[model samples]
Target: MNQTAVKRLYLMQVGSMPEYQIPIVCYLVQTDDNRNILIDTGLPEFIPEEASDFVNGQDVVEQLASIGLKPDDIHMVVSTHYDIDHSGRHAAFTKAEYVVQRLHHLDAESNPRFVANRPQWDQPMDRIRLVHGDTELLPGLELIETSGHVPGHQSVLVRLPKTGATLLPIDAVPFGEDFSRNGQDDGKNPDAEAIRASTVKLLELTEREQIGLVIFGHDRAQWEGLKKLPEYFD
Candidate 1:
């Protein structure tokens, strides 16, 4: 019997804020075929004055370099959502194709908050691949539309060889505490019911799939416990 090779996954810590003690990070998945998939880009070194104090100089390019990778090494960039903190430094990966939900792309284009940071994703339309609900990016990697924090928000589910299932709930459940409480209304997304529903859906999927681990977005305590860069979960 021939055995299938498992893809390698890494959690890259890009930046953090002292005030909230939240570390901004991204995930890198190396496919069996040697392709690199980036989940989300961290905040840019220079942000708007309103957010200047929160984000410091932690370059994503430098973070990738620490793992012996470069910006151009990335083949695919997956935007969980168009939030500034998530997609802020996406322009760094110039050669990669961007994957975003159709609804997200539309929302970012019209939403004034997203439009203000448009330069981060100013790449040509040809480089973008707009996916709908529940799209599969690779054999064992799938994008699950969670859509609560934002209209087109999604989470990634990676079926690992030894680890079984690992879910990346980026901002869909910003913190484990929020998940424990059944999610909160952030007022960013008007549909509070949709957010709650998405959270429940994730919980159901987690139970049904027997997910071994869940990486919550902006979870300070959880982030601290995770294996960072040079270290990774197989």
Candidate 2:
């Protein structure tokens, strides 16, 4: 039999970052071999109305149900970082092996920014597969180590059979201006140098791989143009 590849990519809008007025996203990848991989669970079960600010969508579990997937159906979970919006629903999945960069996990232990989110992403050590630097987690799926947005932050690249390779530089390059402008400091992350380097790395990869589809982390314009769930990329 031929090697399995990602057969479907689902883009799910889990909530909105009201302060910035952009939709918060998470993704689901269904492989041709009947495996599912989740990329960054959305918000937690509850948040004060004040904290929610304005728009908020369904939780990750609920979103998964729309396409007939439960928590256990997921085989792997990739945590790009521990930011509140990205990792809030992580505790919902107990069966999947969580993947994260070792340094990011270490930094999360003491870094105030990430420490606050320990409860969300600090899964059992037995189930956490901490990798250093970049790695190909699956045949067609590769994790791009792109720190600076936060320490040990990582991005994703999924090469599908029909749709081709897609670059998902989650938070590493959240906005299109980060690309057209050559990755300027967004004032959100102080590690501007790291952010720039990671951006350039992703850009070079995008060029070398000839990747045409790039699903950014929280770009409203980009999200609006995408083929959202119920519609798969492949």
Q: What is the C-alpha RMSD of each candidate to the true structure, in Å?
A: 2.2, 1.8
The regions of model 2 sitting more than 4 angstroms off are: 48-55, 186-188
Deviating ranges (above 4 Å) for candidate 1:
1-6, 185-189
Report the error of model 1 at residue 74, Å: 0.6
What is residue 224's positional error in candidate 2, in angstroms? 1.0
Q: Which pairs clash inside model 1? A: none
Error of 1 at 194 (Å): 1.2
TM-score of each: 0.92, 0.94
Residue-level lDDT tens digits of model 1 in 9-123: 8887777777888878888887777888999898876788766655654567887888788889999999888777788788889999999989888888878878746888757
